[model samples]
Target: MSTAAAELRSQRFAAAVPDLERIEAMPLLAEIDALKRARNAVVLAHNYQAPAIYHGVADFTGDSLALAQQAARSEADVIVVAGVQFMAETAKLLNPTRMVLISSLAAGCSLAESISAADVRALRRRHPGVPVVSYVNTSAAVKAESDICCTSANALRIVESLGVPKVIFLPDRYLGHHVQQ
Candidate 1:
C-alpha cells in the first residue's frame, strides 16, 4: 500500500478503535463469529445496521438487493440477516433451500409492512389474469403471492416486461406510480 493509503487506513482504524474496544469488551462479537464457523453460516447485514453489527460480525454488508444477491450466491448452509424482517425474507426467497435466520425478529421496515400476503391474494383474486409484481421490500410470503419480484432500480423494466397493460404493484405506491408512468 502507498504511504498515504496506509496512513488513511491507520486513521480509519484509529477512529473505529472506541467501537472496536467496546465490541472486544463483550463476548457477543466473538460468540457470533464462533457461531458462524460452527453453523457454516454467513451473516449479511444492511448498510443501516449498527456499526458493531456491520463492521464486527457481518460477513457481507450492503444494500437489501445486494445482500439478498450475496445470500443467494453464498455457499454457506445457513444465512443470517442482520437487517429488517423483509431482508431475511428476501434472502429466504432467493435461497429457498437454505436456512435463513434474522438477527432480530423485531426488526421491520415500514414499506414491507404496507402489504400482506392476504392482501396480495385478494388482489390476485380480483384481478384474475393481471400479473402482480412485488417490490423486494415486501415479505417473502408477499413475493410468493406475486408473479414477479422487482427492485427499485429495475421496477420499470420488470413492469414493462410483463407485457400487460395493467398490473398490480404493491407496497410502494410511489414506485408503482413511477412504473405506471
Candidate 2:
C-alpha cells in the first residue's frame, strides 16, 4: 500500500474502533491486506459488517445494491464478501466468471430464508399475470424466479419502473409495506 493509502486506512480504523481494539486488529488487518495483494482479491463489505472488517480490510463497502454494482465492475480474480450469504450470492451472480467467497457459511438472512423459489412460483400461480418483484435480500433462486430484483433503496423505484399497477414483493413484509406506503 502507498503511504497515503496506509494513512487513510489507519485513520478509518481509528475512527471506527477503539485504540486498543485497533492495535489488536493491526496484525490481522496487515495479513488480510497481504493476502489480498497476493491473491488479486477485493473485499466487499456490507453496511451491517463489523467496523474492524469494514474499515480495516474492505476494499469497498456499501449496501447490497452498491456491493453488487462494485462486484460487477471489479476486475479482481477473487471477490470476498464480508456480509451475508445473499450478498455473496449477488456478487457471484453479477460476476459469474470471478471466484466469489463469503466469510461464513452460517451468515444468512432470516428474510431471505422466509421465502423460497417454490414460494415465488406459488405466488406466480396465485397472481397469474402480476409481475414478481423480488427484494435483493432473496436467494439467487428466488431472484431467478422473479421478473426483476430490487434493493430496499430502490424497491419503490423498481416497482414503479415495472409500469405495472400490481406486483408481488417478496420475503420482507416490512420492506414491502414501506414500498407500499
Count of clashes, each model = 0, 0
The deviation in Å at residue 142 for candidate 2 is 0.5
Best by TM-score: 2
Candidate 2, residues 54-165, lDDT tens digits: the string is 8888888898888999999999999999889999999999889999999988999898899999999999999999999999898999999999988887899999898988
Worst 10 residues of 1 by lDDT: 1-10
Badly placed stretches (over 4 Å) of model 2 are 1-3
Off by over 4 Å in 1: 1-14, 17-26
The residue pairs in collision within model 1 are none
* Model 1 lDDT per residue over 1-181, tens place: 2356435534543465576576463477667667877899888989997766666667778999999889878989999999999898778877889999998989999999989999998988888999999999988789888899999999999998988899999989999999888
